[model samples]
Target: MLQIEDVLRDRGSRYAVSGGAVQGRAGADAFVAELKRVKKFAKATHNTWACVFSDLGPVKADDGEAGAGAVILKMLEREGLYDHIVVVTRWYGGVHLGGDRFAHVVTAVRAYFAALHSAQSR
Candidate 1:
């Protein structure tokens, strides 16, 4: 699995993104579990994720942050990424970020793509 940790920070909140190849819903679930195995991720306030399989279409989970999963899913779809799972983790800072939270999610996912591209280019 590939991870882009600490993608962005704002208003005391921190964001990270992680992802890798997955087969289906079960694979996506396992990928999420694997991420949470990391101590910090396990303690995060929200762990939203989304994925698309050529065979299974799209799948997502908000993990308590409403619409977060859909936001990730839409980005993945726009990127034409398939058979992969991407997670956006946020550690809340005890303040409401409102719509800015969605923008953060997009930033995290974009960071993941950038990191992924960098890794593959190595």
Candidate 2:
């Protein structure tokens, strides 16, 4: 299992990104299980996540972050990533970022992929 953590701060809000590998086609239930394994993000304002399980297909959840989940899902689809799950936990700073929030989510996913590549190369 691979994992990386990153925090993206913008508009007074902080987005904590958790990128990890999903063993086989773990399904949505396994996605939730992986999330429970991490205690830090449990209390986040929004824990939007997306996963690509090639065997079972792709699944995503908004967790109250609106279209943020879709943003991550699109990235996963573009990369053609398989057996991977990326969770972005946003701690709302009481400020609305509007469309800009989508950009931040993209950044988080990109960072995760980069990290995943670097890890594999090593």
Candidate 3:
């Protein structure tokens, strides 16, 4: 798995991103489960994620923060990433960020991609 922690900080909210190769829905679920096994992620306010499978198409979860899953899904589709799931976990800081939240999610996903690419290059 590739993880980029503290990818973004806006207002009082903090975001982290993670991703890994997965097979199908079960694989995605397992990946999420593994992520939540960490105490910090398990307590996060939201853990939005998305995946595009070559065989199964796209799957996503907002985990409470609405529309975030779609944002991640679109990024995966745009990048032509298949059989891989990307997660953006947010820790709310009691401020309603409105549209800024979506932008933050995008930044987090991009950070994940950068980290993944950097890892693969090594």
In terms of TM-score, the best-performing candidate is: 3
lDDT, candidate 1, at 30: 89
Indicate the worst ten consecutive residues by lDDT in candidate 2.
Answer: 23-32
For residues 1-122, what per-residue lDDT tens digits would candidate 2 score against the true structure? 44445558887888767766666545555765666667766767888888888777778889888999889998999998877788877888889999988998898888888887888899
What ranking of all candidate models by TM-score puts the best one first? Answer: 3, 1, 2
Which stretches of model 2 miss by more than 4 angstroms? Answer: 1-4, 23-28
Q: How would you order the candidates by lDDT, starting with the best?
A: 3, 1, 2
Q: Write the per-residue lDDT of candidate 3 for residues 5-118, one digit (tens) a residue.
A: 889799899999999999999999999999999999999999999999999999999999999999999999999899999999999999999999999998999888888888
Extract clashing residue pairs from model 3. none
lDDT (0 to 1) per candidate: 0.93, 0.78, 0.94
Task: Evaluate candidate 2 by giving its C-alpha RMSD to the native, one decimal.
Answer: 2.1
TM-score of each: 0.96, 0.85, 0.97
For candidate 3, the lDDT comes to: 0.94
lDDT for position 103 in model 1: 96
lDDT of each residue in 21-120, candidate 1, tens digit only:
9998888988999889999999999999999899989888999999999999999999899998999999999889999999999999998988888988
At residue 78, what lDDT does model 2 achieve? Answer: 94
